[model samples]
Target: MSDVRQLLTSLQFADSAFPSGFYTMSHGLEGYRQARLVSADGVQQLLADLLLHSVGPGDATALAAAHRAAADGDIELVQEVDQRLFASKLNAEMRTASVRSGHQLIDLGAELIDQGLLAEYGERVRLRSTPGCQPVAAAVVYAANGVATRQAVASDLFAFSASFVGAALRLRLTDHRQAQAILLQTSPVMEQVTEAALERNLTDLGGFAPMADVMSAQHERAEARLFAS
Candidate 1:
């Protein structure tokens, strides 16, 4: 029964339809497409790079740290993780998107679950006292709801991959089938990233994707963007 509950929680948070607002942000993929810096094949490489450098050591690491903190009933530590992850984002849109999604997750989780810690965290987010990055909020939800740390990270990573692939499809870089192929090929990278994330902590939450950061900064000023950064 515990396993089933964990699976359900993971699925609920990972679902693209969960109103996390993740669909609106491409995390700079749209900027890459607009500059012609990425093509169909390039999408796979870009996703792989993001998985390995950006999301892996950064958000996923924060998520793992936050999950453990939450599991230990350490709300202050979770908030610190959230703030640190937000600082690591580097770009305004990237930070905004993360906090926005994080708030949404917190709001939704407050309604869906009866966890006092989530409510307290949501209040902190609402007060603007903390950055409340997405990974930290997701970790709170997963940990508070009984999802294992590794599985929670894996679910979050998969959701990220899906969002990126969806962006690629909208950019006409890849069709539905090709998008699936990209996702399939990127699974191993996600596993590696999850493993790396699980071994890291808040102090280790930094990303090396300078290009993605540049694209995000550019995307903020792009005259015509189909997606937010």
Candidate 2:
């Protein structure tokens, strides 16, 4: 791909533009803020923690697995990825959020592109046969559209990390400059995270961020909320 085309693809999948419903998710940011366990620095650290332990190795890994499955035309493997993602995500709110967003993306993609495998799987998920996570669906679509699996996974990482940053923005936990600085700092290292994840097998994917899971669980029951999980 030309440099310009690559830049546009990157921008299209960017958190600010990608409409995978990430804007609606705070991923426990609400609970953490409510519990006073997060401030500006805490926001940065939480973003860091989420990126390193949760998203980078977890959802991003799931995306890579989905991409590989799609590339091989292995829908069964993709189904396994979906089931594993569904089961490993302990928090009810988090699981619901993932599947709900995935459903939206699938419905939208089916109408907009009709990209064979994508259209089929989107319908599959809609029919309650294949429960996919949004990141996985997005990665599969990206892979089918000629983007490399690694780049697709990398884009997924940035998208996942920025959701927290976006949440921090809305919660007043961090300002725009801090968010930009954090994203910029993580830019170079994103590849390392993506590569390690893409190199893994889907079924064995596992990550433990108990505090994050707990906070997400707590956010589900918060009397008031800014974002959905």
**Listing every candidate in turn, what is its Cα RMSD in Å to the true structure after a full C-alpha superposition?**
1.0, 1.7
What's the C-alpha lDDT at position 207 in model 2?
A: 73
Candidate 1 per-residue lDDT over residues 114-219, each given as its tens digit: 9988888999998988888999999998987889999999999999999999888888999999998999999999999999999875677898998888888899
Candidates in order, TM-scores: namely 0.97, 0.93
lDDT of 2 by residue, 32-72 (tens): 88889887876666776776777777788888888888888
**Which candidate wins on TM-score?**
1
Reference-based lDDT, residue 33, model 2: 89
Off by more than 4 A, model 1: none
Residue 229 in candidate 1, Cα distance off native in Å: 0.9
Show model 2 residue runs off by greater than 4 Å: 1-7
